[model samples]
Target: MLWLRSIIYYFLTALIALAISAIAGTVWGVAFALCVVSIACLFHIFNLHRLHRWLENPQVDNVPGSFMLWQEVFDQIYAEVRKQKKAKERLAGTLDRFLSAAEALPDGVVILDDNDRIEWCNPASCEHLSLNRKLDMGQPITHLLRYPSLRDYLKQQDFSHPVIIRITRPAEQTLSAQIVPFDSTRKLLLSRDITQLERVQTVHRDFVANVSHELRTPLTVVGGFIETMIDMPSSDAATRETHLQLMYEQTQRMQRLVEDLLTLSKLESGAQVREEEVDIPQLMQLLRTEANGLSQGRHTVEIGRLDRPRLIGNHDELHSALGNLVSNAIRYTPPGGTITIGWEKRDDTACFTCRDTGIGIAPEHIPRLTERFYRVDRGRSRNTGGTGLGLAIVKHILHRHQAQMIITSDLGKGSEFAVKFPQARVIE
Candidate 1:
């Protein structure tokens, strides 16, 4: 419409020029019309130049202003420019949000270009691959993580399976990495820290093997005693009685093992224990008596002062946990060793501690003491009539009661097993 108006104005100007030429001289009128047309063209050219300059470096405040057709043209171009700027801003915002979400993820994320160059990576990826995010940009992925397995996996583009890499630098860690191809050339490399998962799997395998071995020992003894009784049916009564007694002991051992296994299972299954106010003084007295009975004069069992008399937790579970600790102290302590049971509050935390002058655990073995069937000395553990699940049971019970078992020991000196209940569970 602006162009049509401009064209109409030019036609009218020509008509006026023709009328002037008819009255005055054609040369003067025609020159005047040419001058007017030249001036209009120059004005349009000047506006176009300004628009071009603004397009080269667009700023919101520097939009060109013009008149007539040129004005319309400048306005249209400026509006389109503003629309494009908004679209770009929206796209940038979305990209920022996507990057933020990726950064927040626990798993490592790396983006690679067609050349396998590092385009972007999250913090977790940096830790997993040990890559410097600032310096490693545009560096080849293979250059940073130079493991043969990762290089081969990327080269083959076989993303069907994730590759596990064990890293020894910085720390011993296991990472599972997989690459996914997108947009033909771009790839998303994802990695997860699987160290804990691997440890759990190893523990599972050990538990199964240990269970089989533990069950087999008692079953073998029972089987041997039964065979002896059958073979010596015609022998003297004294021999038969000895065979029967041996068989009963083996059966009892088997029973104890099965019971411990069941208890561990129940605890692991997250079964909630009954909460009751337990008398710590009474509990300690009972444990002292039981410990003395188990010690059979071999160890000096003593019940110390109980600072917190009542505890809000499962009485039975507490009994079992403290009993296991006391029993362990007695079993490991040699003759005339002192074993003390007591409760004390340290900084609002109630602790039920069993300290003994027994043969203390080695530093390295203490970490794995709570594992099922884990024993520092298998022969000694068996001779002591331990099922090897006592500590494990104690650990789970403490967990249920919102408590923790802290074991401190010095090799050949003594060990102290302290069950520290949280402040909330301690009743004064």
Candidate 2:
């Protein structure tokens, strides 16, 4: 329609020129028509120049205006330019949001070009791979990472699994890195910090091994005694009774071990604990009696500084935790040694302290005492009939009750285990 309008306007001009030629002398009328045509051509040329100038630095507000059909031409061009500008803005906004999300992610993200060169990366990516965002842009990834395993991984076309690599750029870290091809020419290099995950896996493996080792000894002893008794069916009653007694002890040890394992599992499961006021003085009396029975009148279990202040926690769990501590003191202390149990307010925290005059722990062993099945002396621990989960159980129970245990010992002198409950948990 616009082209047709332009053609019609030129046709009308021609008709008017012919009309002028017929009315006046051919020479004068022809000259007048040429002059009019020349003026019209100049006006059209000026508008065209304005349109070209506006197009060079196009903006909606500065669109060229014209008097004739050129006005429609300029208006259409302006509308098209405005529509494109809006679309571009929308795309720009989307890109900005995508970058922001990537930046906020904890996992590292790097965009790689076809040449395996870094194009863009988030802060986490820079920290994981030790890459400088400004300096490493367009740098080949292989050169910066410099790990043989990573190089081998990149060489493979398939990325079904991530490559684990240890890096020491900023600190010791284990990174799991994988490449995902998004386009034919570009890829995403993603990385995650698996240091903590790896540690947990290692701990899990060690825990299983320790549990198996601990259970195997008692099982072997029980099996051996059963086999001996079965082979000697004609033996005397006293002999058979001894064999049966040893079997009973081994079975008892296994039972205790299994029970402790179950208790530790429940503590670690983050189950809700039953909360009640724990009468500390009454609980201490119970512990002293249990300790004397375990001691067999060997060590003297005495109560000292028995404060009346109680605690807010699960009574059964507190009893178990405190009982474990007292029993440990009895087992480690020699005959005639005095084990003192105390409940006292030290500053704002209520403390339950058990001090024993026994073969004390070395400084180095104190740090790892709470680890599962960690025994300072394996032979002595076994002879004492310890499950080796007592302290570990104590640690977990204390944690649940928002308490802290402090240990102080001098080698060969004695050790003191003090559990301090938080002020909030203390019922003064």
Candidate 3:
């Protein structure tokens, strides 16, 4: 419709010029028509120049103003430009949001271009790979990480499995890195700190092996004794009795191991311990009695003053934890060694301390004392009739009670194991 209007207007103007020229001659009419056409073409060329100039440096606030056909054309172009500008703004906002979300992720994220050059990376990626986001952009990822395992993994282009890297500098840490190919040639490098996960897996493997090994020892002994008795049925009564006793002891040892393992499983299964107000003095007295019995008058087992008489926690769990400490004291202490069990209020905290004049532990062994089946002296630990899960159980119980176990020891000197309960759990 706009084009039709424009064409009719031009035709009318040319016809008017010809009618005016008719007063002169045919030659004059043709000349006037040529002049009018020339003027119209020049005006159109001027408008086209304005449009071109505006297009070169277009601004929404500075839209070109024209009349008639040129006006309509400029308005149409401006409207389309505005729509495209809004679309671009929306796309930019979406991109920003995506980048923000990626930045907040705990796992490291690195974006790579088609050439495997670092395009962008999140803060976590910088920390995980020791790459400077500002300085390392456009650098090859392999050059930055420099880990042979990572380089090989990337070079292979087999991203089905993530590669694990153990970083030794600064601090020991483990990272699992994988490459995800996207946009054909581009890639997303994802990395996660798997130190704790790796440690847990290692612990799980050790636990399984230890459990198997522990069970096998007793089973082997029991099986041997049973076979001996079966084959020597005609042997003397005393010999038979000794074999039976040995078999019974082995079975008992196995039972204890199984029970401790079960206890640890229960504790780890997230079952909440029953909370109750336990009489600390009574518990200590019982532990003292048990310690004395275990000691068999070999050590001086003393029950000291209990400053905090009551504690809020699971009685059975507490008993098990404290008993383990006292028993450990008795087991390690030699004859005439002194063992002291007591509770003291230190500020708002209550501490149940067991100090023993035993063959103390090495500093290196103290940190791993609570680990399951971690024995400082394997032979002595076995001879002491420990399931090797006692300290592990103590740790779990104390953790459940919102408490901590603090150990102080020196080689060849006595050791002190203290269970520190928070004020919320202590009733003075």
Candidate 4:
């Protein structure tokens, strides 16, 4: 192409010069035409000198801050470099944001290449799926994960449904996993931990079964008693009194059980609570006075400054919670055992303590104390008319208020229940 264009240019220039010379020969002379041709030749030689000098001088290629792009070859190369630079910058930004968001996600994320090789993994994936990213990257996804269910699920290539795996290799966890395929090449594996949700569901199921079973016996006893009384010809005075008292006690027991069930359900279902500034001093005084009245000179009561700590919560609920604690203390304590009510500011928290020289709880039973209907000693609890839900209610109350509870007991040294009220719920 270069040779053809150069040949065409020379022919065109020769034709133009010949025409000029022919016209000049007729007007002037052969000598004048020769002079015109010579001048044109000299001018061409001068331009060639400048072009050759540039090639000889290396500095001529250098411009301010960069190589000169005066030549066609340099210009083409420079344009290609600029395009690549911009593309690199755009790709770098996209990669940075993608990695940042992937890191922030709570669920596990795994990226696979077209060859089903592990390309990338998030921190959560490493923790939940038990795979070391450093050793697993670039490895086949199947060889590393080694989960039979997952392997079978992936082989089917069905993304229409998510497969849940109860992970239990290094530790126990539940995962809801989904595989999303892209362009028949790459795949995205995502998994979320649903251990807590599964645990709650199991607890609910067990609770329903146990509650129904427990109620059956009480209901059956009451039913048989009612039937017998109905068939007893309206009952004699002695029999009537005996049956009536027993029925009343059973009725009360049912009432307490129903009330506790409702309370627990409300607490679990995120029920709204009324919060107010609870005066610790006034509340303590009231509880002490109530304890005295209920004591009937049985137990000695001691009250302290309580650091004048203030808390914020529903007064009515707090009253019920506090009253239950005090009542339990009094009921469990021996005639001469001392009961002390006090509060103190520890760090940013206000702790309300109810220490009693009462019947202490066993170590093995402490863990399930907050469980609904759990009893350390069932016979003792029923004899004392305890509903087996006092600690459960206290636990839920503290949970709603974002507080905490600590129960410390020695087999025979009496128990101390310290309820830690967080600063978020404290007025002072």
What would the per-residue lDDT of candidate 4 be over residues 171-247, giving only the tens digit for each residue? 78888888988666899988899999999998789778757755675677678778888899668889877877887
Clashing pairs in 4: none
Candidate 1: list runs displaced more than 4 Å.
1-40, 144-146, 224-241, 296-299, 335-337, 345-347
TM-score of 2: 0.88
lDDT tens digits by residue: candidate 3, 1-428: 67788899889977877787777877887887888789889989999998889889988767787877888888898898899899999999999999999999999999999888999999999999889988999999888876899999999989999999999988999999999998888999999999999899999999999999998998999899889888988989999889889888888999999999999999999897678899998888899999889888899999876775599888899999999999999999888999999898888888999998899999999999999999999989888899899999999989999998999997778999988889998887
lDDT of 1 by residue, 341-366 (tens): 88988897888888999889999999
Better of 1 and 3 by TM-score: 3
Q: Please say which candidate is ahead in lDDT: 3 or 4.
A: 3
- What lDDT tens digits, residue by residue, belong to model 2 across residues 58-169? 8988888875678788888889988999999999999999999999999999999999999999999888877999999999998998678888899886799999999876
The C-alpha lDDT values of all candidates are: 0.89, 0.91, 0.90, 0.78
Error of 1 at 406 (Å): 3.7
Full-model lDDT, candidate 3: 0.90
Worst 10 residues of 2 by lDDT: 24-33
Please report the TM-score between candidate 3 and the true structure.
Answer: 0.87
